[model samples]
Target: MKRAEQVTFGGGGLDRAAHLRGDRGALATAWADPAAAVLLVWQGKPLSTRSGRGSSPDQLVMIRPDHPLAASHRENCIFLGLAPTGAPQFACDISSWQPDALDQAMLASFADASEQQHPDLPTGQVFTELRRMMAFLTPLEAELAATANAVLSWHKSHQFCACCGQPSQVAQAGWQRNCAACNTSHFPRTDPVVIMLITHGDQVLLGRSPGWPVGMYSLLAGFVEPGETLEAAVRREVLEEAGVKVGAVTYLSSQPWPFPMSLMFGCAGIALGRELTIDHSEIEDALWISRADMMTVFAGDHPGIRPTRKGSIAHFLLQNWLADTLD
Candidate 1:
């Protein structure tokens, strides 16, 4: 756990200027600064410069504040923070813009492989799925994109006040919503999820959902319910999904999983027994794989299983476990 923050979307040293969130004058001044830049999000995807066929890395496309698109959406801009060089960073949602020949079906699929291009933007810069490009982005880019997507998704889903059931207005530089009717303030929410790496002897437990691709499996995970601790969540989730009792749970690392806003808490647990009576409703299959077989899976030599996605906490934990570096 010493390298806990080394996980993707956790170690980035982004200077989130929280002091300026409620300062309208300071925000306006920062917005007018020449060093100010904006990132545009369309349908939950951030605009990025596509990576080349070989060596290039995909980067977030930083648009000038004065750009036509950014300017038009200025009223709804969220102040993300300041860059390392003191430049102001902001994000705007342009989900209203429709593209030509748009395939609605692909956009709603499990994995959206399509890229969207705006007519006014430069060529090669498209709004791509974050999941598809997360592993290839720089640490800072990953952090910024995750923050923007989470905050924007929150605003879209929580437009009304929970207290008075009245429409709320953006406040605190997009970090909060205020309702005039009840004078109530609501902040962006981040749900906590516990993903466990349960082991017995030299074997680890993994499960695949019903619709997962063939040969794909990952550590069992579930949401942390109200009044439940992280340790309790891990034990309960493993037992519920795979009928495996877990004990001695310990925290490992965490990742900001912004697939609609979640913080994944990666933890290690010891399994009391190797027997797996998978709950068919919770998972399609569950099994215990030894360390040797897991190595083959990581190396693409295993015929029955594929490696977990890169940039995910599951892969990070499993890799560290394989190298005896989980401590």
Candidate 2:
């Protein structure tokens, strides 16, 4: 887990500049600087620079400050404030709104000189695949993209007061939505998920969810229910999925998974039993394989197993486990 932060969007020590976000004057000053860049998101998809030919894919909804909606909605977005190297960062999601300037030309328009694709331009798609195809994003890009999606999504859903039917107002520098009628405040949410790598001697257990592609198997994972500790979540999830009792669960690492806001807690557990009676309700299939078998999977030699998805914490943990560093 030494390279815990190495995953793309994992940890780059971006400046964040939390203290400055509340200062209206400073925030306006940073945005006015022409060098300041925005991470573009439309319905949770981060904008990226395009590669390859195919008429360039139409991705992202972005425009300059002169645009009409810029004033009304931009304040609802989070100002990540600054990157570690001193560049400013911002995030905005333009999903539902119609930007007058959007067109095929946008697919070729590069953002901030970084060569990363922003999103799948066309409609009727979730942001999942677009995120997967990205190789990486600059620290500024990552910060802007994360902030925009997190804040905008919160605003879109929480326009009304939870305590009363009255409307709310944006507060906390776009970080909180407060209801004047009921005096209730709401903030963005991140769900907790426990992803575990269960190992016994040289063999490991993996499971395929109901809808995954063929050969796709990953570390067993589930949400951490109320009142459950991380270790208890690991033990219970493994047992519930594969019928494998686990002991001595140890935390490995965590990743911010922003597909609708999730924090993945990665852990390793001591496997107490090998016989897997998979709960079909939680997983489609579960298997235990030796180190030699995994080597084949990693090498593309296993006909039935595929390598883990790139940039996933599951892949990161498995790579460390293979290198004998999980201890």
Top-TM-score candidate index: 1
Model 1 stretches astray by more than 4 angstroms:
51-54
lDDT of 2 by residue, 51-80 (tens): 222455433333444444344457665676
Measured against the true structure, the TM-scores of the candidates, in listed sequence, are 0.97, 0.82
Note the residue pairs that clash in candidate 1.
1-327
Q: What is the per-residue lDDT of model 1 for residues 1-327, given as tens digits with 9 covering 90 to 100?
A: 888887777766778999999999999998899999999999999999983335787789999999999999988899999888889999999999999999999888766889999999999999998877888877888889999999999999999999989999999999999999999999999999999999999999999987777888999999999999999999999999999998899999999999899999999999999888889999999999999999999999999999998888999999999988999
- Candidate 2 residue spans exceeding 4 A from truth: 51-72, 97-130, 138-140
Ten-residue segment with the worst summed lDDT in candidate 2?
109-118
Consecutive 10-residue window with the lowest summed lDDT within model 1: 50-59
Error of 1 at 264 (Å): 0.6
Clashing pairs in 2: 46-118, 47-118, 48-116, 48-117, 48-118, 49-116, 49-117, 58-121
